[model samples]
Target: MATEKLGIRVERNPPESRLSELGVRQWPKWGCEKSKFPWTYSAKETCYLLQGKVKVYPDGAGGGEEDFVEIAAGDLVVFPKGMSCTWDVAEVVDKHYKFE
Candidate 1:
């Protein structure tokens, strides 16, 4: 008897990220320098670095903002539902992500 490994990739943005004007919600994999977007209350996302680095900042207004969290190769970060933040990729980045 023999066994085999199997896998599949699902690229769909969470409902909140989907625009009503656009019937389908898809976040394709790509490389970029930096990106910024407002996270909706319903969206949840996770990111894994396959090449470069990224800095994540959680939403809040305060005297002193928290330091940026660096995410590089082999690093994983989870953004939960209702969480809002901005993501900045200081170095070119290639990543695999799935949202729901």
Candidate 2:
């Protein structure tokens, strides 16, 4: 019997270019409490939840409010380009993100 390995393509930006183009920004410290933070969307962003839960609100013009979507551990969230939103963290959470 023969088995073939599963293959996947992964693309990464150049470290030097990434560092130069996008300098390191401070990540907010979260705790087991409700917290809201404003964020501007650019290009696109992919996020993976590692711990806790959070709600993302997409920017909307209706009374300065937006739609909310909940995300939790083992969840993948994608925010498309030109989307402005706010992150409402209900519990202490940590996530890994990739932005383009």
Tens-place lDDT per residue, model 2, 1-100, is: 1111111111223244443353322323223456888877666765545577776666663433334666676554556677776778887887556677
Highest lDDT scorer: 2
lDDT per prediction? Answer: 0.51, 0.54
Candidate 1 residue lDDT tens string, 1-100: 1111111112223333333233222445556776655544365655555677665565662314444455676544455667655667777888656577
Task: In candidate 2, list every pair of residues with a backbone clash.
Answer: none
Error of 1 at 91 (Å): 0.4
What stretches of model 2 exceed 4 Å from their correct place? 1-34, 61-66
Q: Roughly what TM-score does model 2 have, to 2 decimal places?
A: 0.58
The C-alpha RMSD of each candidate to the native structure, in angstroms, is: 11.8, 11.1
**Roughly what TM-score does model 1 have, to 2 decimal places?**
0.55
**Model 1: number of clashes?**
0
